[model samples]
Target: MKVTWVWSIAALALVAAACGGGADIEVADAWGRPSPSVAANGAFYMVITNNTDSADHLVAASSPACAVAELHESMMNDGVMGMAPVGPAGIEIPANSQTTLKVGGLHVMCIDKQAEFVAGDTFSVTLEFENAGTVDVEAEIKEG
Candidate 1:
């Protein structure tokens, strides 16, 4: 009986290990373009790494530096390049994959700037994910 119980416990532990678990979402290379005080908007970029077994969504973003923060995308429309908001649904980060927020692509649009985002200036932005929760990222303003 003792032998059988020990074997059953070992099997359960192995199964648990194989199932794995959720991993924290990682934000890296956080940066933003320098904007003058007169400018009403700025752009932020970064790489989001999803290390979990399940996929996640970057549902929202916010910052104290701007009156409005939103996910935006740039694309060519009928031969004319145009930029637009990504909507409230937000962007997706696949499981075990990386999503990059870059210029001329997907990015965080900081509108109605409360201060100038000049070179060397830093600010914090909160990224809200569907499963990973909220993460605070410090973004530096500089030239890429």
Candidate 2:
């Protein structure tokens, strides 16, 4: 009887995790730019919310739509705005806070795009997190 009770508790825990009952990370507002047919580069933007007491980091990303996918930040230099690649550690999301990846800020830079991005098109981007493991998000291409 004790063995069965322990197994039931373990099964319930697995089910809760599978349903995101213990998930500390949440993604929303995932979007990307619709590049011209001749363009070879694209970008993605979104909001990442951390609800847990511990912080987390977005370590990496993968997508079939781009040859190189990485985090980047836009900065102003000498009155000119330019983009630079993020560090190996990637971006950080504080506990009980949210991170916004938007234009003129933090965004996912997709270089050497496999194909041109168009309106009404969607693509998958798998984001690797420090504690959340991997979460795949569907990014919608829209006019920016």
Candidate 3:
């Protein structure tokens, strides 16, 4: 009887978590462009989808290949497009919505790349969220 009661409680907790829907995040279409060996920096792109009722923020990003990885944005200034690091608040992921990290927009800035981003190669990047915890994803090297 005690074992049955414990199992019942555990099942209830699982159901509650799924139905509550708090900070459930998923990453898809993660890819990075080819960077020459001499290049100092590279970028990664992906679609971050939030599948819950509560919103969350992507606080940071890191990888073994980059000395520094940061959330960055590209915007137009004086009729020319420039790239800069994102603010301290990081990137907002609205509830039940998705954000795209693409060229000419928000992306993961891989600074001082430790290795070449060659085509057909793969690397790992870890994304840290304010509430959803950390997600490890493989980034495929490709050309646009």
Candidate 4:
């Protein structure tokens, strides 16, 4: 009876660990807000931390609030600022490292807004990764 009980507990623990029972990657202070007035498109910023000792890449992103969702990076050319889509290569997050997606750098650009993103509201963005797979994160809208 004692041996059976121990096996049963071990089986339960294995099942729970396989079903995301362990600690997960932590994402905090994720904020996205519409650009100031006159800006047709807006950007989203967040910090992704990889707690595990495994590498990950953010490959794609999608949002219901915009007609088009893409990973973008800002650049300067001849004193003019421009934004362009990230190519096939995805953003890499090394093991035990944090990647910050911020303004004037790398961000998720929501184009052709379907509905205005308001502060204090939350929206979902699905992020596909190479190692970590797909992670759906709730982005809080805030005033930038």
Q: Write down the TM-score of every candidate.
A: 0.82, 0.81, 0.83, 0.74
Model 1 scores worst on lDDT over the 10 consecutive residues at 16-25
Q: Which model, 1 or 3, shows the larger TM-score? A: 3
In order, the Cα lDDT scores of the candidates are 0.90, 0.88, 0.92, 0.78
lDDT ranking from best to worst?
3, 1, 2, 4
Mind giving the per-residue lDDT tens digits that candidate 4 earns over 1-144? 999999999999889768743434556677787544355677778898776688777888888866778899998899999988887887777887888899888898887766677778887888778777778888888887
C-alpha displacement of 107 in model 3, angstroms? Answer: 0.5
Model 2, residue pairs in steric clash: none
* lDDT of candidate 4 at residue 120, scale 0 to 100: 81
Residue pairs of candidate 3 with colliding backbone atoms: none
What does candidate 3's lDDT look like per residue over 27-111, in tens digits? 9889999989799999999999988788889989999989999999999999999988888989999988999999999999999
Cα deviation of 138, candidate 1, in Å: 0.1
After best superposition, candidate 1 residue 63: deviation in angstroms? 0.8
**Weakest 10 consecutive residues, lDDT, candidate 2?**
16-25
Q: In candidate 4, which residue ranges exceed 4 Å CA deviation? A: 1-24, 35-39
User: Could you give me the TM-score of model 3 versus the true structure?
Assistant: 0.83
- Taking all chains together, the TM-score of candidate 4 against the true structure is 0.74
Q: Estimate the overall C-alpha local distance difference test score of candidate 1.
A: 0.90
Best by TM-score: 3
Identify the leading candidate in terms of lDDT. Answer: 3
Model 1: residues with Cα > 4 Å off, grouped in runs: 1-23
Give the per-residue lDDT of model 1 (tens digit) for 1-144.
Answer: 999999999999889756644346989899998878899999899999998778899988899998999899998879999999886768989988999999889998998998999889899999999999999999999999
- Reference-based lDDT, residue 53, model 4: 86
